[model samples]
Structure formats: C-alpha cells, structure tokens
Target: MSDQRSVTRSDLVAYCDAMLESSAFQDYCPNGLQVEGRNQVRRLITGVTASQALVDAAIEQGADMLLVHHGYFWKGEAAPLTGIKKKRLKALLENDISLLAYHLPLDVHAEVGNNVQLARLLGWQIRGGLEPANPRSVGLHGELETAQSGAEVAASLERALGRMPLHIAGNDRPIKRIAWCTGAAQGYIEKAIALGMDAFVTGEISEPTVHSARENRIHFFAAGHHATERYGVQALGERLAAHFGIEHRFVDIDNPV
Candidate 1:
C-alpha cells in the first residue's frame, strides 16, 4: 500500500469512475454509485452480473456495497423504469444499497479484466483485441502456449470453470489459435472465424452462432457467461478488499449456459 491514507468507498468509486471515463460514453444506465447506502463501506459483495437474484442476495447479506460486471441499463433496453427495471431499482433503493457496476472497462483492464483472467486460466497468451479500431475492444484473440486438441481444450474449460463447454468442432484440427469474448459475445464468432482461429469461445451462445461456426469452419465453445465472468469481478473485489481492509465475498448465482 502507498503512504497515502486508505481510500474510502467513495474514493474507490471516484478512482474507478475516472479510470473508466464513465461520463465519456453515453451509457444506458448510470455508472458508479448507482444506489446510495452507507457513507462508508466496510464489506463488499461481488457477482458476475447484476441480476435481480444478485440484488436480493446482497440485500439479505447486509452488504455495504455491491459490485458487478454486468448491471442494469444496457443499450437498446427500454429506457423507462416501469416494470422489472423499476422493481430492481426499487429493491436497491429500499435497502439503501450502493451498487457499483463495471462493464467494458473491466473487460479490457489488461490485468484484472475478464478476458485477461480467462486467458490466464486457460493458458492462452493474448495477442491483441479483435477489433483494432477501438482500443477498448472487449473481444480478445490469442494462442495457447502449446497446442491442444479440441477435446483437450474442452476438458480444460470444464475442469477450470466446472462447466462443460458446448464445443462445436469445425474441424478435427488440433486447437491452437483461439478468440474469446466473455458474456454474450456470440456475435463475434464470425470475426473469430475471419481471424483464422481454430476455435472461438464465449460465455453464451445464440442460434445463428452455431450455424456460423459450422459454415465458417471455426470451432465454437459456449463456456457459460456467468462462469467466464466470475473471475474479473472477484479479482477486482479482492483487490478492493485488500486495499481498504474491508470484507469481500463473491456471491455466485449459477446460470446454466
């Protein structure tokens, strides 16, 4: 730790807000300090994505602050806070719970980002972002330290994450080059296919993604978004806990992918 005074929850939020440049992007939902609760937070709760279940658990646990990788207010979602959205917000507000959300920022954070963490866990070395134009591209492409067969890679994913990946083998080729984007990034399968990757991995899958994988001759793996995303938030939360000497618990609400 630095010689400076220990940072508070607000200080952490401020640091994250500044680092993410939250205000620069037109976000669907409010970023940083969504629901205000205790002025000083001592215990932190983290989860893969902020679903209603997560909110309820945090409230039940009496968490001082809640951190999540996915949160409310996504692009193209209805702006009106009327139905489920209203209910979710009301739950937080009623409990006076503080909500901290990090999305793309956390995904591309180099060290603690979801992609980086996944790569490390799977023994892949990231080369660069899939999209070169955007510096903060959420999708990452990389290669394994040593090539493994498709089935072998599947075993690695299953063993590491406890979720058997839905592997769509495009070829009998040994797996070497792989592209990954955690959390509902099936849209990028074609991009991975274009990159000549032996396989593409993501947290979730869509109907068309399967066909695309077959047609493009790129292996596809749906590794469960919740499973893939659990790493980054937990890493970040642990860091914050150590930095502030606060209790941190990563709450997992399993979602079958």
Candidate 2:
C-alpha cells in the first residue's frame, strides 16, 4: 500500500514515471512535467492527445495537472515557439497547470493500452504483434472467439468506439483473425496483410490506404482516432485516482475524425 494524501509535484512525477516507464521510449518531447506548476497537486485531468481544445478544457475546469498521450516539442517540429505552440504553452504557463505526456508507453501497457482496452471491449483474444520484427510494435493481432462477417465486426467496433467505422471489405472474407493499431496507423495495412489478417482496424485513414486495402485483399476499417484513444487516458486517470486518492476527471472533446 502507498500513502495518497498531500502529494507534491515530485511525488506525482515519480508516480507517473514509474507507471509509464518514461525513460524507456525515445519520446519526441519530455515525458514527465513538460511545464512545471504549483508544488502540490490535488486534481488530475487526462485526455487522449494534447491539443489546443484539450488544454482549454483543462484550464476551464481548473485542473491542477493535465496528462496526455501527446505533448509539446515533438521531434521534426519547428523548435521556435512563435505560433500555435507558443499560444498553447503560454496558456498552460499562465494558468500554472502541469503538463505531462506519455506516448508509446501508454500504447503498450497491458492493462491501460489502447489496443488492449479495445480488445477487452470487443471480446477479442490477442495473439501477438502484427509486426513480428518489433517487440514494441503498437499494432496487435488477435481473433474473435467466434466467426463474424466484416460488416458485423464493423458494427461491434462502432458500438465500442461510439463512431461508425469506415469499412472497406476487400474479399468478402469471414473475419476471424484481426489486427488493430489505434490512431492514424492506416500505413500499417501492409503489416497486417503480411500477417494474414482477415481484417485491419485503425483510428484514421489515408488516401493510399484505400488502394492498399483493395490491392492487399484485407478488410480496412477507419475508426475515429480520438474516439479510439479515449480508453487509455481514462484507464490512466482511474489508475491515478486509485493510487493517489486525487480527484480525477476525463474530459472528452468529441472529435468526429
């Protein structure tokens, strides 16, 4: 057991660092405490990815800290803080709210990962990674307990994610083996195809993905990225609430994409 009352900023960082294993991933930005704030924290808010809308919502709700899957200062982005990035940071700094981000680590956690949670929701038994070469590969391959048509699986996905998935069935195949990677991983279609998956699911779609799906003869489903990513943040928030006895809220900004 651990004490949960009156924790300091350092304590919170240490807690998140341990939970997310921040040191392991080659993250684009600093994983923990990108922007410092008050020494003590009592309330925690979590969102899928750090966006302007999410930051605004956290500030409006008077959150002491905000945790996200995506944070500021990503690699390949302009180093200068002069545009939208500047405004976001300025708002966070002025409000004195701490920003913490965890990317790949959040996607791979057994209990709280996006793929794991999706599988739990859809009753899929996970087998292994879609990419055999990469252990940290976020895409997962699994099978339904029973057989289902491509349309039926799409309906299940829509119900679980609260958005009707964009379905592209290639070969009228009955789906049993499935591969999924949440959040704009349409590019992984080839990986899923190589794994001989009957269906592949991801958060967003690309123009080339349509062609890939047709050419490779694998069912491709584009569920909303924001919708798919909601679970991990909620799980992480619940974990924090249980661990630290703090007020935890998951603010959902409904994104249609």
Best candidate (score: lDDT)? 2
TM-score of 2: 0.93
At residue 91, candidate 1 shows an lDDT of: 90
> Model 1: clashing residue pairs?
203-225
lDDT of 1: 0.84
| Runs with alpha carbons beyond 4 Å of true place in candidate 2 | 1-4
What's the TM-score of each model vs. the native? 0.90, 0.93
- As for candidate 2, its clashing pairs are none
Would you list the C-alpha lDDT of every candidate in the order shown? Answer: 0.84, 0.86
- Model 2, residue 193: displacement in angstroms? 1.1
Cα lDDT tens digits, model 1, 1-257, are 24423346678798777766766655556667766776777668999877899999998888778898888777787789998889888998888778899887787777788999999988888998888677777889999989999899999999999989999887788988989999889998878877788999998989888788888888899999888988988888888877777778999998886
The best candidate in terms of TM-score: 2
